[model samples]
Target chain A: MNEVPHLMEHIDFDTTFLVFDLLAVFMFAASGALTAIRKKYDFIGVFMLSFVSGLGGGLIRDAIFIQAGPPKAVTDSKYLLVILGAFVLSLIFHGSMHRLKRTVILVDALGLGAYGVVGAEAALQEGLVPLAAVLVGIFNACGAGLIRDVLIREEPIIFKPGQFYAAAAILGCGIFVGMVELGHADHTLAAILATLTVFLMRILSIYFDWQTRPVLDEDDRS
Target chain B: MNEVPHLMEHIDFDTTFLVFDLLAVFMFAASGALTAIRKKYDFIGVFMLSFVSGLGGGLIRDAIFIQAGPPKAVTDSKYLLVILGAFVLSLIFHGSMHRLKRTVILVDALGLGAYGVVGAEAALQEGLVPLAAVLVGIFNACGAGLIRDVLIREEPIIFKPGQFYAAAAILGCGIFVGMVELGHADHTLAAILATLTVFLMRILSIYFDWQTRPVLDEDDRS
Candidate 1:
């Protein structure tokens, strides 16, 4: 009985998990800010992208679930600070980051892994069912990127010819749920397993040049 | 006493509103399609801009109020059909609307008014207080356009030096509630008054070069 209460409290204030989530958000925000900077987006656009890329997914998920408040990106000042930091950093190193294609892709893969794991973890913690958790996780991982693409008036990456991006997120979420079921809910193990699963899938897809066929609707079918 | 239910049911299925809302959505979708074509956006971008501009505001309002699925646009197939019609029309007369700057703004203002009224009425019906209702209405009216702006990576008209676009929306909605409270619940009269109010405000602003003051952080600090 005592152990149950302790576990509940542990879930409430897990400093390690919180720090891990923040790190994931920071990585995602940095990538988004860098992309906006490269596109020559003005200050407001860059700020908006940085904020959205860090928080858009979570906001969508929370809104869908009817969770109260404005999501973490709005509620937590620290997240905002981190995004600002990333934006400033991106501005300083824009030339180098823009030049190295390999480094950029690597950072993107890391961001994908981190966001995927964190999203799945949030869903599970919120007591969502496994299937819903996976779906939410996928959205959490990709929603910001989708918004980024749409704002740039580009076709979303999901609809583009590319390596399996969404599939990696889904895989990571699935692995996370499986690990939790097997009682490996420790912070380090969860992060490592989920990140590796997504990162490997993304890398393999890039290596093999895997792509999903686009849905083509004939003109004037309407 | 029994007349209350009959009134509620009548208002719930007000056919005049149904027609006006559809017309407004069609007009706005037409503008979005034209913009997309002018920008030479791909099929997805064109389709997305049209969809977002048509439905984005209502969706935002509904989400803010924690209302249930699909909102107005998603629930009605006519909204989709209207957008498709607009897209087809744009393709046919692609060069024509591009040169008619004054005509474009007039049509856009009409659409904004119509959508703003719908948003205000919906919020009132949903039991939001007057202040909240007006806010919701403004959000619904401008949310789609804001999304369009963000997607196009332009400074949103709201954040730019412009006439009080959002303020106009709020004024329309405020009048709508006041009129309804004064027993002007007749759909046609309410719609006409509210829409005219917004349209005139928009026109006056444009003519006079009316604009909101910008927020200067340095000035504030001083």
Candidate 2:
């Protein structure tokens, strides 16, 4: 905290990363809106879900872990605009959302990977320890889904026995940090490789219907 | 953000306030543990609920809105120790929690008010505008219950069709912030008045079973 105000002066992010982050947010908002529609929620619910899906993880990451000035979501107007746009489009095409499920899932994997890298970068830039950065990265990637599930009264994917969702981000972020800190790799290269790993793992898991057993499920049954 | 560093250097809090904050956290943690046990959760569940209930709102406030250093909950190990102590005590007295319901509620009201004031003060300390500090105060008072309910697959009390829970916090926080900012009152006097407001509101609401309706519930039904 003592050093937080000092670090704020040094915060600098490039345009390319910003664009990718916005794209990820847009995709997540769209998915969230579709879920809200499926749940029979009203326009407000649609906006809420969209907002949470788009920025929830980053919200948690920046506020709790980064302790950077106000969360970027609130400080930057662009984030809200992107989320609103997604909510509107999702509602307009609510009837056709079912048809676009595959497309949404495809882009979602990409968004998750991008967010994983972006969140990790924020933490690393904050001078967080490597492990903390990884955890923050995972939070940035999956916290939205967790919050949305709780709101909808369904078990979060991370807590449920499911394919590797958070696990994908965990590996991607861990490797990204490891690469920079241990392997002495370029940031750009590490981000790309880490994102690809998450994207591929997500795609493969979907195709194979890979199942993660609940940690206690086997023991309980036995 | 530019002035944040300067503000940090000037930040100071007294010991009496610190003690009260810890006591509030402990009470909240004890209630969370009871809820976990009632839900048939294991010891880990007890600890998780206790942690979330004890500090979830402060976590959200400090991280998301306050932009202060890492949340006081994390920065201060005493908070964790208090939560752990509550968790252990609750577990040991698990079978008798039901008998202590009336006493717990009485003290819980006190904690809610204390947390409300503490949260508002933190936001105020960070130089949040009056309205924002009030909002943060309400979050501090009841955000834990909302999160815990969501985790347990129950509708949050704030969203339900009964009680003046969040409303109580809102009024108290609003008055506290208003008194300090508009009335030019002393901080200690303002804080005490605000906490008393919350406590009285809670007690009166519970005694009379005061209820608030969902804004849309009546509209849709009508």
In terms of DockQ, which candidate is strongest?
A: 2
**TM-score of chain A, predicted model 2, versus the true chain A, to 2 decimals:** 0.89
Best by TM-score: 2
Model no. 1, DockQ: 0.06
How would the docking of model 2 be graded? incorrect
Residues A121-145, model 2: lDDT tens digits: 8998899998988988899888888
Q: Considering only N, C-alpha and C atoms within 3 Å, which residue pairs clash in candidate 2?
A: A63-B63
The DockQ figures for the candidates are 0.06, 0.14
How big is the positional error of residue B119 in model 1, measured in Å on the Cα after superposition? 0.7
- For model 1 the interface RMSD, in Å, equals 8.5
> Tens digits of per-residue lDDT for model 1 on B78-135?
6667766776776676655657779877876776777777777787777778777777
Model 2, position A179, has a per-residue lDDT of 89
> Please, what are the lDDT tens digits per residue for candidate 2 over residues B123-203?
788776665677668778877877788778785555444566677787888888888888877677777788898899989
* Candidate 2 accuracy as lDDT: 0.78
Q: Write the per-residue lDDT of candidate 1 for residues A123-182, one digit (tens) a residue.
A: 666665554455556667777777778766765665343567876776787787666655
Q: Taking chain A by itself, what TM-score does each prediction score?
A: 0.78, 0.89
Give the Å error, residue A16, model 2.
14
